[model samples]
Target: MTGAMVTGAPETTGYGGTLAAEAARFAALGWMRGTSGNLSVVTGRDPVRLLVTASGLDKGELRPGDMVLVDEEGTAVPGATAAGKPSAEAALHARVVRLTGAGAVVHVHTVASVAMGRRRPGGIAFRDLEMLKGLGRSAHDEEVVLPVIRNSQDMSVLGDRLEAALDPGVPAVVVAGHGLYAWGADLREARRHTEVVEWLLELQLAEERGR
Candidate 1:
């Protein structure tokens, strides 16, 4: 093993392109702006490599090179370059991927999610919503509880609580006073879940305000 150094090979160019596109799209939709959100897509499975947005970079301005490759443990692989350190929520993303075997994770600081999470005394409950089908539920009549956990600066503690609170079948969760975390079998699916959950939360808020 003399003169041998561990290094990470470059991720497929296609993966980087897809990551940048999604980041830009989300940013444009106002789901992730001012570098307030994080997104990741699994690139490889055997070694569990993922292309994730770098911390502190405006999602709207994300370039192909702004994405970094990290392993399942949240360790940055060598040769990957980004504008800043990985998102502080990297650990939480890794936990969700490990638990759900998800291919992608999208986190955002949408106004609806933040407001709903804070106003709801317990957690977010989605029932009889046709949009629920987007989250893999076959019927809209079922109640889907999107667990809302207290936000914390400590990543480890937050990750632990998120893992414990997440229901096996649910595709998303909200962090009280923070934002939402959504995941799916792939990037597109994850993005859809984010949109659906946000819509549900906004509807819930309107209903509450009217009451």
Candidate 2:
């Protein structure tokens, strides 16, 4: 345990490659510019282990070895590897999974999400958009509210607020002036939820500007 380590040897699995690809994809879309975002996938459920993107690496350039295994509390597990530290927000990601039973989580910075979160710190509500279906919601007349929680330097404080505001029906939440966090049953679903929520926020921002 003197050196870095992970359980079940995730390095031998495809988790790293999957995370790297997703990070690169989001980076290309400008949501994960530089090293500002992180993505993770659940590797175990009984004790809740995950493979999260290591901290401080350029999301656009993450490699197959750029992942760290962490426990339910987001503490890196001691085993055997050189994978760097877990993302600063790894705890929040873990909390999301515990709360929602999501298999993957995507946290990213986006202009629309930041702007909307800042403007509506209480929460942002959406309805009557076909895109709602993408979030697994009714697209006709029902409402979907994406919770917004104030950002905190302490992950514990942030996590507590997130828990208080989380809507079981919603797969996404915005950290005011920070970014958005989206999760789903898996990486692909999480990515789709992120994109759909971001699109909805963009549309709302545009409508507000026009008003």
- Which stretch of 10 consecutive residues in model 1 shows the poorest summed lDDT? 1-10
The list of candidate 1 runs beyond 4 A from truth reads 1-12, 138-140
Model 1, span 75-119: residue lDDT tens: 777656534568778778887888888988999999989999898
**TM-score per candidate, chains pooled:** 0.90, 0.94
Clashing pairs in 1: none
Candidate 2: Cα lDDT at 140 = 88
Task: List lDDT for all candidates, in order.
Answer: 0.80, 0.89
Model 2 agreement with the true structure over 1-211: per-residue lDDT tens digits: 0122236555577778888999999999999876898999988887788889999999999898989888899888887346889976999999988989899999999999999999999999999999999988999879789999999989999999999998988999999999999999999999999999999999999999999
lDDT of 1 at 11: 30
RMSD values, in order shown = 4.6, 3.7
Deviation from native of the Cα of residue 114 in model 2, angstroms: 0.5
